[model samples]
Target chain A: MAHALTIHNLKAQIQDKPILNGINLEINSGEIHALMGPNGSGKSTLANVLMGSPEYTVTGGQITLDVQNLLEMQIHERAQAGIFLAFQYPVEIPGVTVGKFLKRALETKISGMNVSDYLKDLRTTMDFLEMDQDFINRYVNDGFSGGEKKRMEILQMLMLKPRFAILDETDSGLDIDALKIVARGVNRARGSGFGALIITHYQRLLDHIRPDFVHIMYNGKIITSGGEELVRQLEEKGYDWIKKEYNLIEEEAHEYSTN
Target chain B: MDDKGIVNTNKKSVLFDYQLNKTPKSSWSADIRKAAFQSYTQLSWPTPTDEQWRRTDITQVDIPGYNPFAIDGAHEIDVPDSVHALSLDNIMMRDTALFQSTAVPLIRKRVETATDIFEVYNLSFFNAGYFIYIPENATIQNEITIRYNFLGTHALASPHTIIIAGKNSSTDITIEHSINNNNVYIHGLTVFLHENAQCRVNIVQNISKASYFFSTGKVSLSSNAVLEYFEAHTGGSIAKTMLDAALDGSGSDAWLRGIYFGTGSQHFDLGTIQHHNANNAHSRSYYKGAASGTARTVYQGLIEVAEHAKKTDAYLTNKNLILGNTARSDSIPSLKIRNNDVRCSHGSTTGKLNKNQLFYLMSRGLSEKESEQILVQAFFEDVFSHVSGGTADKLRKIIREKISDV
Candidate 1:
């Protein structure tokens, strides 16, 4: 069966300041979409709001996972409904070992994951990620290097196998080798039943993963959507060409003045 | 006194003027009790104005309203034959000289110099007690457990426990305080570790929410002695404990860990002291707690290094988690260092559940309650790592119960 995550006229704010100004997008289970934007472009906010982060209030929006209303559900309920968000800065959980945390998460998701089978699956997944066997005993992301933290997030995504995943800058602070590892984790999860919205600022990550469609977001809204040529153009000319073409500087000034 | 050895007297009059009915006049404990009674008369119940009692108001404790329970009969306990685990009254009856030589002097000193009203009160009117002596150069493979269970209502259960670790000996002991509702469990304990002795002591206080519990104790370590002290306060409407570790000899080391989880209207006040009087002493203390449902938890710790104690290393860390909007936690860690060649530091953090951390867990498909429960369990993992065997299992069970209640 196929799943679709749809967002219609999504508008959100933090405290009283508006961030996501009517975000409209639709992602099917099979395709990978890359969301590119400059800093403070509401790309991350969109990802957070999709996962129902309490930090942001959705003043006007409707998010749905197939037939289920995502906005009406709690954060964890959305996750149980197969919506995963790979945090840009994953929070460190002290004293919780990777194996134990993953075991609990997998059990909560799958409900009937036997211990031996879970361990076997975990061992294989961790091996594919090149995580040391002892990594299972180590605390979750506590004192982990930047590259290692990114891999840990990808490791969780692979183990969870969510239907729709939003990678919020999962490629931000990674070297070439670490970047390849992350891309490999995501590629391994790609199939007719899995979809992802990869959010990043650079084209290097998209070069490795190869998104089918690219969307450029500026001033809290997607200004344009196109094919691989769009990513190539942005990589070559930067967001300035889009700003000039869309003529958004004067509108941005007015928006800031209203805020 | 009744035939059951229960004291029959006016509660208030007997609170001030108490007589020892079980012990002979010539017994060592009797003399100590008589001496403690004199000091008990000069003391009064702690008031809210007192600095230590300011956070926990005891003016409404109603100490005299509860009858003094006499648990002189057989207790529910099991131990090995090599260990000398006997009730204080039994020890005084069978071996009077042992009490006079070892425990009587210490009891006298604590009572005569007592500043807290509960300390002297426990000494003067204690109806139940125990004395465990680990022989010299002996290794006790099994853990020695002492269980004190209160069964009566409106009764004051005061018990004294004395543990003497002989030279070059090693052992682990657990003293549990379990009680019924509408009772007061006040206790005094002393542990003396001789030269080269290594001992681990676990004190678990789990009482009914309607009861009040108080514990006061001192642990003295001799040269080359090592002490691992673990305490868990997980019950009672109001619980207060004051335990001090005295490093009286060189090369002594003490590591202390404490944990408390409070719920409902429970209030817990825990006080700890690390006193280094000799050179080359090392001590570390870490205490963590969580509060929910309008509950409150307070941790007061002091690390004191004497003037003559050079090369003393001491550190203290306390962390608290408030699980409810109205829950509260207080952490006060202090240091009094007199020597210049010492290393000492202290830190404390009181906070609610980390929102980001919670969100991270919730994003992993755990419900809010399950996430908080896991976080609370992880919060005490460092301290919980120090204990093992039966005591650790019991602590984990209590933690699960407390977290589930929240």
Candidate 2:
């Protein structure tokens, strides 16, 4: 059976300042959606608020995964419910080896998983991602390059096999080669039981990882929704045409940037 | 009376009782004990005005309130034929005729350097004692293990351990101390490393929660000798230890590492000194500890280089983790370098758990408790990596137990 994630009339804020004015979206398994927006347009805010980030408060909203309430669940519970967020800045944990940390995480997520089977899967997934076998013994993100950190995030997503994933700017600092590797890792996990929300600033990433639907966000709200043609249009004319089409004032849009 | 149930008592009466009830050893041993007792009488307990006693308060600990001569337990000593492990009584009584020609002089010469009141008390009235000696040019293939298990309540016990490494010899040794019921335990240890010797010593102290513990040790190294010393302090209501090492020969190196975990209302005070008196000598000391549940811990470290010791290198580092709002820790690292061409540095850090780090782990589907357990264990990995495998596993088990109890 396919699971669906529904968000209706979502409003959120950080401290007293409002960030997400109102967001309405629905995603089901076996589909991928691309969310493109300029800087400070509440793209990242929506992703973080979906993951129950303590920094953001949900002023008014409703979010549900199937029959379970996502807003009422804790951050870790959301993760346990098959919601994964590939962070923009992966935190470094010193002295915690990648192999050990991932194994523990897998055990917690699937308490009855067979150790031998998990080990075999880990080996195969790492090989598929083109990660060195010795990389598992290295400390988690400690002294890792930017590309390595991003690859580690994808490796975790594949190992955990979440139902829905939110890729929050995972391609910002990657070169073309690394971008290809990351896209390959995500494509390997794409199937009937998987869904993804890819947040990006450029259409280059959308070229490799094709999306079924596209949405453009501005001023903390989704102003337009369309098919893949929207990505090409934005790449050609940039966000200025969208601003001009929406009749948005220049200073009013720039005000969110200062915040 | 304080929480430990200690009350004021006459110190003189307790000393006289111990002297009357003690068994007779060799004539020279008796003389040494008598001299130590005389010196102990002239000294007084450390007051809060003293620098070392400023953070820890012991005004209510009266040594005479408990039975000084009560002892109840046996020790397990495992060693190879290359090593000579003798009880202090066996060496001082049965082997008296050969005492002067034996290795007893190495202990006697070092024991005379004690000036602290607790050190003198341990020397004057030690109920449990052992002497370990590694002969010349014999590299023992097996490790030596010595364990002292005491199960007595409301008792005052003193234990002494002396180890000597002969010329060009090498060995690894572990000494463990534990108690079941409430008691006052004062311990003294001395080690001598002769020329071209290598020695590694690990000391583990895990006493009862209601007990009081005090320990003093000095390890001296000769020319081209190397020593690795590791200590773990995990138990006891009040624990204080003073461990010092001196590099008395050129080209010698000493690496000292220690870890401690305190819970409940326990208190711990740990001090170490790295003294360099020879040219081209190097030493490093790394100590880390964690405290929780209203507990308190302190680490005082010093690196001293003499004026004549040119090209001396030393480093000292201390890190502490406070597990709760009320738990506290203090770290003091100092360096005194007299030579102009020496490199020495010291650093100390104390902090709570990183919230970002915790959240990162939690986001991987682990609960708050599981995340904390992983992070706390990771915090001590750097220090544990330097220890032997079996000992490190055992220490990690103790830390895991402390975290689970929370």
Candidate 3:
């Protein structure tokens, strides 16, 4: 069976400096995967590349979503194709209301829904996220708090109803309560037809939104993959064990060459 | 060499002689011709040395040796549907059969409204125009739109328009200036809003690239009257405009907004002044311009609060967006506040697009061109939102086309 999202040997760089080096990953339908790594391990870079951010150039690779070539589509087209990214730092679009922006995005996606029906769906999503009705009238993330911003990201994901989503550090600066609310919103989005790849540096979020698999990234590459236990082990022992293991493998390879 | 010919035979003989030969002495147009001839000779064309014209060069304005076209039955005008969308019961369509049939009487009455020397001169020389009048306590629901189309080379066209809003009444008017072919265009207008009346005016100048166009508007406001004006200029080799409003009554208000976009070798100059004479009056002005290629733009705004005009409030702001290395813009915002206990301020800024904004939009799915268009539209949203009527939709389309061209 085909995967919902697939990245094959993706090599990307920023100003001649390789960031995502031969990275490969795939998420099947209804699967939630957590990608955890140390600082500068290219976790954010992977998410940005998947979203086709112009800031990072893909030197070589292929990213496909449900048999569609993701690399060839525009950012908005990728979004309309049911691929959504809950940015770590949501951008503020002034003079545009949250409700207005959501309606426009939904219209761009569906294109045939009338204003009344769109508003009805939006009100339902807002209620599901436990968001205040007043939030809809405010400018998109203009003066929203960190927690509010995170909730808004989830609100969009819920409203847009994308097939595949990449949540990049959604819990970075959130408090425990805010993190729980964000995880609840994400969990609500997960079902038999949805798939997600959550990028985080800590295992706290994993405690709330349990992942089907956990991937450990080191030096811009995924070195290990395991079940939920992997996150627990990495949280207790940290990435030092993974680094030593890779070092030992390198030493073994060097000795064999010398012999 | 007859006495009649010699009497006009001076260094400026060609000016009046040409006027007299082209117009009959007994005709109403002859009076306008003589007045314009005298004003043309008496008031020399504004020079670059003048303070108001310091930033704009008028040497290439094409002022000499052109006769005004006479309004005749042969001159057929096709009124676009968009122009009629702003029709009001009190406002007559300038090109309708009824207006065409009663053109002589309308012109006579419009000529009689001009008592000022310069206005009288314009009246005497005006050939084709429109007259609009609103009765007391009568409000117009739609905006009145007038379109002037010129279609020949070296042809001089001066279309005069007069608007009168009666006491406690309100209405909106839009005047569109367009040229189908290369030509010389000169136009003037006078508007009067009575006590407690309100009027909104939108002027769009989309002349031909090869044409030289000049327009002037003078407005008088009564007590508690309000005027909102917007001007959009995008074409012409050399376009000069002057808008002056006098707040003659207490509690009157005026708001002026303008936007100009120029490319190639186009030169656009805009001047505006708000004269406050009544107590507790208020005024605000905002003008912005975008110039690309070798184009140049100049904006001058003045807010004058009289000595006895206490409790007055006024503000003026001018901003420019420069797109190319050779494009230039000059902004001058001045305030002459003579009264105490009044609030007044003026500001001006000139800069290019924000790099961060461009990158932000591009990162979200839009190309560089699309990003620029969004930012430009966002910048002008405030001005366009204030515009009410079908004309707003048309103006939006025109701006969109211009953005795509860029």
Fraction of true contacts retained by every candidate, in order, equals 0.79, 0.62, 0.12
Q: What is the DockQ of each candidate?
A: 0.75, 0.70, 0.17
Alpha-carbon shift of residue B109 in model 1 (angstroms): 3.0
Better of 1 and 2 by TM-score: 2
Model 2 per-residue lDDT tens digits across residues B1-406: 1223222365554555456346465445666677677777888888788898898888888765666656677888889986888877666656644345544565466446667888878877777878888999989878788898876778877878888888999999988888878899888888889998999999888888889999988888999999999999998999999888999999899999999989999999999999999999999999999999999999999999999989998999999999989999999888888889899999989999888788778778888888888888888989888777888888889888888986
Q: How do all models score by TM-score?
A: 0.93, 0.94, 0.75
Most accurate candidate by lDDT: 1
> Order of all candidates by lDDT, from best down to worst?
1, 2, 3
Which residue segments of model 1 deviate by more than 4 Å? A250-259, B1-19, B24-26, B70-81, B96-100, B337-341
Candidate 3 has which clashing residue pairs, if any? B32-B124
Screening candidate 2 with a backbone cut-off below 3 angstroms (N, C-alpha, C), the clashing residue pairs are: none
| Each prediction's whole-model lDDT (CA) | 0.87, 0.86, 0.75
Highest TM-score: give the candidate number.
2
First chain of model 2: TM-score?
Answer: 0.97
TM-score (C-alpha) between model 3 and the true structure: 0.75
Selected candidate, larger DockQ, 2 vs 3: 2
Instruction: Give the top-scoring candidate (DockQ).
Output: 1
Off by over 4 Å in 2: B1-21, B96-103
For residues A1-259, could you state the per-residue lDDT of candidate 2 as single tens digits? 6999888889999999888888988889988899999989999999888888888999997999999999999888998999998988898898789988998889878878788898888889889888887888988999989999999999999999999999999999999998998999889889899999999999999999999889999888888998899999999998989999999889978896576
